[model samples]
Target: MTTPSTLPAAPGPTPAPAPAAVPAPLPRRRRRAPKAPSALLSRAGVTALLALATLYTLLPLTWLLLSSTKSRADLFGTNGFAPGREMHLAENLEQLITADGGVYLRWILNTVAYAGVGALLAAVFGVAAGYAFDKLAFPGKERLFSLVLLGVMVPGTALAIPLFLLAAEAGLVNTFWSVFLPGLVFPFGVYLARVFSASHVPDEVLEAARMDGASEFRAFRTIAFPMLAPGFVTIFLFQFTQIWNSFFLPLVMLSDQDLYPVNLGLYVWYSSALSQGHPEDYLLAVVGSLVAVAPLIAVFLMLQRFWKSGMTAGAVK
Candidate 1:
């Protein structure tokens, strides 16, 4: 007990702990200036502008949908934005199908054939060309690709006459081949495929396939094409939509009502309404237009995810 009491002279009164260091005061941040009134006005203006743009786009479709539900009487008499007093959509559809010996159905079938077959072949060619551009080196490759880019710049409308002339020379004008063949040449699809190839596909994998004694075509079929699926879907949808909506080209090439796409057929009906004073033709055209629009919407909805992913994939490293 005594030894414990004498330890280190009682530890020199337990040396008071060093005074706690006070941290220097932090520098204060500068206060933000109040927002200017113009800043608020600018935000409000931008919001208003976007709202107007949205309204502009949706208003027409809204009118189309509402009008499609109405009979001829209601379509012209009732509120443009409001629903019909009685839905005549079924009757309109029946008229659309039965009118002119079921020509509308034939037009639909022709359009589907044109859009589907053309888009399919175009996507295939475009993917092949794009893959060649990205992976396979050849003489005049860059120059050829530049020519393709030039093709993209040339509007389809501008090319309509030239295409018609080419079709005429081949004795294909006014035939399905005339429209189908032109749609198969999608330079933009080639460009998009090249972009997707560069982004999504790796050269190492291709080299590995080649090392495994795979031919270029075999490698593409088995390895590259699968990897480029998103791009292919995107291209197909684009080409399909393009061919589906092609009016000027078909108009320039075809005079036969039997070969008319839905759009052209609807236009024929609409023109007849104006010139021949057929009231029912007007409603038929409206309903036909709505029907024609359905495929586009359906295709977009079904494939939007793939399209979005394909588009975004190219943006990444």
Candidate 2:
């Protein structure tokens, strides 16, 4: 009977293969621990400090704007932050342009020439010198660079007297060339260009161009120059700002009011206002100060993207 039962069991459905075991999900990586409260507080503190710094920097600019709106009498009579009884900005500007046979306009044009031309020349020379320093192998390269670093550390103001003397010796004093020539020698710009070239310009690319029979000058002009555009722009802007705001150098070099930059002209007006007791000159100075800053603001607004890109260009690659 048992044998008969065993025989009957043979027809039963075969057991399904045991389902393949699923891999237990990999242990989930432990999530990063939440930042400590102290760390969060530090970040908040840093953000607050930055905000305060920005406010401090902007405070004077705010005062300038408010002061520009006031008449000469209101400028001193009222709170520095308060608006005047009447906005004299338009009238002040009209006086600014028309005063002294439109000498202010001439000063603006002179400033453009000095800053624009000087910055352009500085960019060219700086880029070329930097490229040579970076790519070329020669004796005394490091020493020359060190000398440049020394020059950078030396304030341009400190050299103003010597530069003036040199200009005098060269018979360039009291001329546009005196102010312009000095601005063209931007050691810091060369340093910056060298730093930029070392990173942005690859040796391999230059070698490849050389292999293609492109002369070094041609390669630099067509290839390297475009790659170094950001650096060039940075150098140009720096030199432009320096030349534009330059007071002592131009003051020492230029005797002609026609050759005076806006900064120098403004200074003359401010001095005359203070010394000659002309209250109207004070209003003109304030308005002129506002006008003088506009170009710089416009320049920054226009080139801000380029400036940012240039600053961060080599940071990643």
Candidate 3:
């Protein structure tokens, strides 16, 4: 009976455990100040550089435009940007056309033939070579491609002599074939074509074509060539411009004025002008150059869409 009445322990105040130390918030990393001034300065510098580059490219053309309108006296006397007292562009063009028994027209025709035909063949040949290189498994493929790369690195100037010799051996020197033949072999076009073929021509599509009983050439012609049309335009434009501007090769290859490209023809006339100090000759060259550049501008404007597509071909979707 005595053990049945146990009392509970009395409640007592107890000290609170010392507060756990709060970690000091890490010092906020000081945000770097914006380099607004330096950034502005860098942007300004780049903008200025590009502006200068544009000005540099356009300045000559502007001068050519202005000078072509000037009379011989005005060309030397007027401010380069200023229009002349009278427009002589018509007079200059007439003179250019009639000069030296109308040899300038002959040169223009020759240039068209060389650049136009050569570029077409070059594009096809390069694209085919590149397609074969990328798609076909053949012995000496890499080795042959290496040679093409080596050819690319070697400047046309370096090859002029060797080519001249080869043409001489073949009795093609001083003929249209001399300049036209060399322009057809475009190493850079081949390289670009390989890249384009690798990017644009899917292996799956080619395999599917094979499965459908299409021969390799038929697949290439029907399926691949259409895909590579932009690339063809690109290569054609490049080689066409190259052959159009080609001077040294033509100068070395051709002794006959009849076979001279427009560029070479101009060189001959310009040299004659310098030797004789003929203002009329100088005026003729200016007009001729202006005329010559028009075709290039037209071609580029017409084909810019294809060129842009070709350039951005390998971009991810």
Candidate 4:
């Protein structure tokens, strides 16, 4: 039976069922949300803040300026910011110069000596030490640097008594050296010098200088010094300001009035005016303050360019 035409052709081998049709997936097109702009304060708000800060800083100085021009009666009687009936700026200057047999001039000279010479020496010392610290290798270098950093944290007031004691032992108390010598060891200046040296002075330049038959000191003096000039000026200005405004150190060291710096002199005048019931002395004090601030202003103006350069020397790459 199977051989007979394959039994109806074996039902054509039971033809396979047609496969079900499947749809293709659509291409995914993801849509992203737009980002919002960042919020910022208006320009007016920033300008207002800066103007407020400037007013706060300059308000006192403006009051002092106005006060310096007032007469003794007007100084206390009138509003601090108002002009007096009679301008006494000229009279105040005369009195300031002639007081205590011209002792204020002595104070000015003493301040110059202490601040100028001391700052110069301190710059020299600081720059040399910083260069050595940055470039030279020695045992205990890091430890010594750490000590210098520690010194930076110690306030000048804390060191005044010890410095006075040391000066007394060295027979320098009640002398100009007592005040001047202490101004020569500014740890902050050294720290700044080190930072400047590290950032501004390259090792390869120094090495090249050495290869040109320059000794260490010669190399520093010729090559490194030029590179470190901005740093030196920065250190000098810092030390100068510190020495100029120093009061406690001079108070502890100098017993003689002729050796007083401007700050101590002003303090003495202010204290005497308070205790002696002398109202004119109060006007004198105000005038003296104005006079004292003049030099600092002049110095800042004169050295503004150098100061700016020095301050920003190591800031950028």
Candidate 5:
């Protein structure tokens, strides 16, 4: 009987919460400026220096070429770069060959034989010594190599007198053997051989060869010598140049004009020019100088591959 109806409560509007404070976004970072082309300046400077050095070296050569083209009268009168009215190069070359009963040709042949054979022999001996020093273990190896280093330090010029005496004792003075014998024992060649062998011929490879029943000499001849051929060329070329351009030893050893190398022969011409008051010899001297450099150039051009390969092989492990 007590039924009562409950009434719903009336809704009221609520106040909005105060707006939360908004924070400002941080500024975007600016990227750093790229580096300036400072490297280009360094490269430019190096290029300029190299160019200047090249010019310095080539300027004299140019002068020599132009001067060689001139006649005796034009040589003194004409500016160094100016071409002379008379191109006497052909005449000068003819005169060089025919002059002094063609002694210059003899000098040329003598030089070739001495430099070619001596350098070839030196390479063989040097490589053998170097290989032995690098690969073989023996008593006095270090001591012997040290002695070799000492020999390298001794000036070739200083040894000239002693060499002269030795030649006199052997009665080899005024002979090709005097020059050839001394040129065979290049201390630096041995040094380079040791260096190259240490780098190129791995001990492990030699060990493997030995384990495979290869004798030490057999392993060297079959395996190591082939690897060392590039070094051989290097030593050969070096000794060749040394022997070709050698003046002092020849000067001391040979009294015979026919036995002189290009260097000593040119020196003879130079001295005769001064003494005889013949400036024509001056032109011959220049022409001979140019001719002397040709073979070396040819050698480098022909064997450039071996040299470059040897160097690259050396740098690798």
Candidate 6:
């Protein structure tokens, strides 16, 4: 050990006791100033977009409110949103009622009858068809459902000619039945019913009822119907709105103005206003438009509970 030979002299001086490894200056974390658009600006951008949308929707409603106050001359002559000297809404309504043996009221009654009866029948048929498709093991179930889905893609406008022809063959053209019959054949309603039944009516439930010796129809009526109630209301509301706002079908089928729904009736007024030089009918069209929307609003408010409940049920298992 004492005789351990000295190592040959190295070319470079021995490095001083290896300095503790420093972490390569840790890439100087240049304390960057906050990004130009901070979180507050991002939130503000979204709020501004929503505000613009709200203003766009309400702007026309605001104009309608102001327009309702003006007389016929003021409607076209005055600035659109400016209030006029005469508040003629009451006078206009009175005239509207007295016209043609108060045919507008008859139109209103016919609309209610058509929408109510048609929507009820639609709901019933849709529910039955949906229940059968969802619960029953029938031939061509998927194929039939695909057909129904395809029906949704067929524009109602395109079917008007064929429907008119069928109604003509049955001698039902221009009758309330023409409208009612078509409304009852709602493929969309059937689709919705199928979705609701599949989601809400568990097979376990039907099996349990079957085990208890309950008839199939009895099981569905007593057990499945309750769960389907929320879905039914939603379907009813959707169908009702469809029938209520329907213009093209009634326009083609029913020649009688009194049989017209509000939408069709208003359209007639709009057509008349266009041909006739009188602008009074223009005001009527606008006011009638507002009134037509009111029932839909009321229905939505009344049935929003079902809609909300249905959405919740749809999301839950």
Among these predicted structures, which one has the highest TM-score? 3
Q: Give the TM-score of each candidate.
A: 0.85, 0.85, 0.89, 0.86, 0.84, 0.83
The best candidate in terms of lDDT: 1
**Candidate 6 lDDT for residue 264:** 85
Clashes of 5: 0
Clash pairs, candidate 3, are none
Q: Write the per-residue lDDT of candidate 6 for residues 1-317, one digit (tens) a residue.
A: 48988999869876689678777665667798866885546889889888999999989888887787778878888998788888987876776677657777787788888888899888888888888899999889999999999998898889988999999999999898998888887898889999999999999989999999999889988998888988788889989998898878898899977678777888778888899865667777887776667777898999899889998975666
Better of 2 and 3 by TM-score: 3
Cα lDDT over the full model 1: 0.92
The residue-by-residue lDDT of candidate 5 on 1-317, one tens digit each, is 99788888788788899999999999999999987777547888779888999999988878878877778889888898899998988887888899899988898899989999889988989998999999898999999999999999998999999999999999999887998799888999999999989988889999999999999889988999899988988999898888888889899999989888988888878787889987878778877877787788788788878978898884655
Distance from true position, residue 96, model 3, in Å? 1.3
lDDT of 4 by residue, 34-123 (tens): 665433355776778889999999998899899998888898899987889998889889999999899989989999999989999999
Query: What is candidate 1's lDDT per residue for 167-281, written digit by digit as tens?
Result: 8889998898888788889999999999989988899999999999999999999999998999999999999999999899999999999999999999999999999999899
TM-score, candidate number 5: 0.84
20-87 per-residue lDDT for model 3 (tens digits): 99998998899998766664369888898889999999999999899888888998888999999998
Q: Give me the overall lDDT of model 3.
A: 0.90
lDDT (C-alpha) at residue 214 in model 6: 99
Locate the minimum summed-lDDT window of 10 residues in model 1. Answer: 3-12
Model with the higher TM-score, candidate 2 or 4: 4
User: Which candidate do you rate higher for TM-score, 4 or 5?
Assistant: 4
lDDT of 4: 0.88
